[model samples]
Target chain A: MMTSTDAGLPALIARMTGDEKHAAASESTLDVLWVLYDRVLDVTPDTVHDPRRDRFLLSKGHGPMAYYAVLAAKGFIAPEELDDWASVRSRLGQHPDRNRVPGVEISSGSLGHGLPLAVGTVYGLRAQGIGSKVFVLVGDAELDEGSNHEAIVLAARESMGQLTAVVIDNRSATRGWPGGIAQRFAIEGWATATVDGRDHEALYEAFTTPHPRRPLCVVAVVEPKSGQR
Target chain B: MDMRTTFLSTMEEALAVDPRLVLVLADISAGTGPVLAAQRRHPDRVLNVGIREQALIGVTGGLALTGMRPVAHTFPPFLVERPYEQIKLDLCHQGVGAVLVSSGASYDMAAAGRTHHSAADVALLDTVPGWTVHVPGHPEEARRLLLESLPGDGRVYLRLSSQANARAHLGAGFLTLRQGTRGVVLAVGPMLDRVLAATEGLDVTVLYAATIRPFDAAGLRAALGEVADVMLVEPYQAGTSAHHVGEALADVPHRLRSLGTQRDVEVRQYGEVTDHDFVHGLDVAGITAAARAFFR
Candidate 1:
């Protein structure tokens, strides 16, 4: 029900209240999601189930109001469903379910699942001789999950050129990375980029740039964590 | 050949036949494993995710979603317990199926201590619905089960232990090794030999089962004719099959007892798997006593 003509992140989120919403999780990945749906990703409402359409997986699924907002703005889902998210009758839960949601690729409430799922998807797509690309979004804090490191290393070794891992950094990783977040991925032979999360044009450029014969990892540096920012 | 070797060779066959076959490992190497060679042959399909178990399972989900049949392999606890949530959400909850092949069942790696022992692996898997569990007693059975998982989209948990039965069961389901009139003893996986040894003189029929999930309720009911006593001895956990047995015999009044590994108390004492088996009342002497008492 929500169309781009009258919908914004604020209006969509305002519909779902007192439903255990994750404001910070959605806010941190908001700009990244917007940039991907609006300009970077080739998937539209029509091509959601098409094999040639680009695939976007939300690994950072704690706060999905922002994701729902973007999907609604792009006409992937009805705007009216936003008001009853996480309800007993609603298809949406605290975590997004791929079976219930229209555009969700993988169900994620648990951290460290998205990157590996994306790598697997890329490998699967290639096996079927399909060339569509996969993009997965995760939180900086979520990197602490050792699973993401496994995916990072393996994807690079396989030269997963069609896969892209986007880390939305809010300075939340416990015992943070040494040189920088992108450096960790770079050590694993990934083509890396570091950009400001809020800058729309920078985010779009980083996503669109080509990296031959290697998986792409983009570190989107957002504002400081909650309470500090 | 051992179950490990059979599993690898069978997987190689699966890969040769189906282009969709993808093998995922977690830093586990079995004598220059076949998958490693396949990795060189097809660099994209054979993936070693290091020792990360969560991603090992999660990646299988992604591969399955992309219409690939994935086989994720690792130690039991590392494969099942650590990334259980990943299996639940990414694979099961998503209604996608992947073959999870695990090594070191219970104290299979007894020398490796508690970290390697997965006595509760099957029971933990039992908590989740819709998984076909195969505790293969022999390499032949493991080979058959692994080959069977390829063509379908059903989820399967293939448990291969270091301890194997003396003979390969070239077939599946409950094979009637001995006939008796007093009671029926169901032996699961490696427990078959020990059960046969325990009931050497008892007037009880023994049935061996490697595929324990599809329970064979019809076979059990048919085997239960004129017998009201049934004892289930699993190599993994005790009382895991008590409910299944009870459900099968609900209409007919009968006595059902389950005997296997004990999970109630922590057995900090570590030695040979035989010691753990003795502690869990799965030894020959222990199973003999439980069988006699149940039939009495």
Candidate 2:
């Protein structure tokens, strides 16, 4: 099994073929996934359903190859399943299906949906008196959805310190829209931070030590290489 | 009593009974009627997420996740249409226990014009899985359904109106107003009062569905039983309830008659009218009259 210490996600992604590679190459989200699988998310193949396992929700789920690849590498699924990605019977598809995938907590693909569900999961855990942390990785473009802003404001008011919202910013907010989501989140009273998307250490730090009294909003600034796809 | 007053008093009673109950409001504060007063009485439990529909649903999902039962309120149109994805993915997909209290159905927002009127909420919500759609025709049913949703795990959409004084017969599943030898009339939400008034002294049974999603199939079959004709009355589109009943009772040799607004975008015009006028304009009266002709 490919372990977390494997060098560079790009090299690993290059080895993939068919829909899996195509999806991974299209977006720069793989770097964030690498950090999640390699060092941050505290889950093993055997302990995926452990009650105390940290939950990760892919809010920006359009290109799911990054998630599939990380899961496959982490031995969550066999590597051969990546070839059937987006097929009629494939568990790996354009969007994440929580029921089909063991590690997935909620099915997500539509923009502005993951944050609220993540919030709900956090709330559910708290209600059951479960102290497990929830990490939701959302695309910067998803902030254009008014619901994301609504969730941000509410999370702050509730002081949902256990929930960490990481905004993966490839700087792809549609033209003319205000792109300063980090600033917006900070203004709303969340404990905000930013990091270079490709840096594993920075991503690890952000996920490991979330703010104790407020939700943590991390904007991972990234830029994909040209002709990568 | 105004339906709003009853709805609020019932909700406050429920809240007093359960510490987990929470009410989240959109921009419209005073407009939600008595529910607003309950929120005011319990400020810590009420969350106003401005006018954002999507965010309102998401935040409510968050609250539900944390062990709090969140009842989110918003304009019917915004709640059903604008934040639809949030409702579907966050609440239904995640299996969160969040109640969506939406005002404005048919003529509920007549003065606010077409933009505010939510004509397709029932039809839209019916398409979503695991979400119970409760279109309470009067105050009492609204109270009961709201109370029932408090301890449940799934999602609920309470389509309400500003008309507070509407009367409702209290019971669970389908309420039979009259027992007829022929097929029964299945009425949804507040339309129960209308069908009952229309069929007074006649030997026709009116089955009022409090929960639209699970839709009491055995209860419906038991009530309608070998009656060869079934008529459905609703404030939503014709196919909404009729289609589901037909699918569920495919083996029963019954002629299904549906009464509601036709599907036509051009016919969209907003105006001030009581529930009676809106139902009558949608040909509910004509359809009932036609059902009588078929019986003869």
Candidate 3:
């Protein structure tokens, strides 16, 4: 019952192994990345560097293979670049370097760092009166970084409508940190929507719609199956 | 020069010259009366991000990224500690030039207790890349440094004290207090007064380093010239400042010494004390005593 788009993902993941696969597996949240790249996002390989293009920042930057895979699939990068990943003098490393990689708006690997940068980018675009939207993907574990809470609170307070903070709450932080996923952002007055991450239709709807009153928080809850990785 | 007065004067001057120079404040603007008045005068430019420290810094970086020169004000410890990642990744890494006005340095917040004290900010922020750390000893220097940083590239941390007294004028590079220097004592921030007072009758040169991170090594060596002993006095940790001075004067036959508190006290008690008492508590006097012990 697998679709053609869904069938291509596992094969792409299969080609990557060892530490690369392990890293990519953590970004199983890429089901959303796939939806964004293939369907929702208004970006093209030719217009990757265009200022008018929508900006996407991978805040949870540890598992870069998923991003790399999506970029390669989108023709933004060559498939051959995957071989040189994490290699010496290679542009592809553990994290995405915007200078080395194309279509990356900001270089990020550190947790809780991207939201504020995204906020800044959105604010910049608003000042220039540019209609470009900014999308940032943050991991649930990054909620532990108080800066994220600070950013969410400010976004809501400022009513920054163009900023969309996508939280991949896979329940990973529960293994280590206190507090549940929703409670942290709810206190900030952000309009949050929790969705099954693997659902493509719901994600597409959540991403494209504009929230004029408040900052939108889409917490995609992904349940990892046993023996999946 | 008293930095508080200089900061207020320069801000007023900058506002007069260019109306675009926006002063953003957190919810704590009432504590900074003059700054709050400036905000009231230029209501369009002044923005309050409430008590959210991280958002305040991030918004400032965002505002600066869009060609607005934002002077974000906050308490020292929370300003650096709360949104440290934002300062590093969002501001520094992205090459945004925003002036961070930190009001509490060392024991400036002694009345507010240890939680408000920003003794470790200099040492912590100095390590971050593309950051210019400026601690003006007095107000005139504060004015010069603030005006200089306004139109410059990259991020700068302006550490201001609550004390409102003028001391000495700071020039470009290191200023040598005495000429015939057998030994040199380098001091940064408000502690220069103590170091200068300590070396009043002594045959030693006192080098007041206005800019700490991009330290003037050649100037420090040129000033120290054949001096046998080298000492660093700070209200924060000695590792960062002492190491920089040591590296700058490596060729010279000199030994480096540092004096500051290593850890915060465990108790949560708060009390009022003069700047001298606060410095003494951090062994600033003891460090000077040790320096004199070696030099004499």
lDDT of 3 at B199: 65
Worst ten in a row by lDDT for model 3 chain B: B275-284
RMSD of each: 3.1, 4.2, 4.2
Q: Is candidate 1 or candidate 3 better by lDDT?
A: 1
User: How would you class the docking of model 2?
Assistant: acceptable
> Candidate 2 DockQ score?
0.48
Q: A1-229, model 2: which lDDT tens digit per residue?
A: 3334464344444444533445422357776777776777777788777767878888888877667777777788777777667788887777888768877766788888778777666655665567777889888778887667667877887788878998887766664236477788888889888888777777778777758879999888788334432
Per-residue error for A84 in candidate 1, Å, reads 1.9
Model no. 3, DockQ: 0.40
Model 1 docking grade: medium
lDDT digits (tens) for residues A147-179 of candidate 3: 787678777777778788888876556454345
**In candidate 1, how many Å is residue B8 off?**
0.8
Docking model 3 quality class: acceptable
| lDDT: worst 10-residue window of model 1 chain A | A1-10
Model 3, B101-203: lDDT tens digits are 8877766767777788766788778768777888877777778889988885568888887653246566777777666567788777676777766666677
Residue-level lDDT of model 1, residues B154-231, one tens digit each, is 899999987778886656567788888888999998888899999998888888889899787877777764677999
Return the clash pairs for model 3, or none: B1-B138, B1-B139, B1-B167, B2-B139
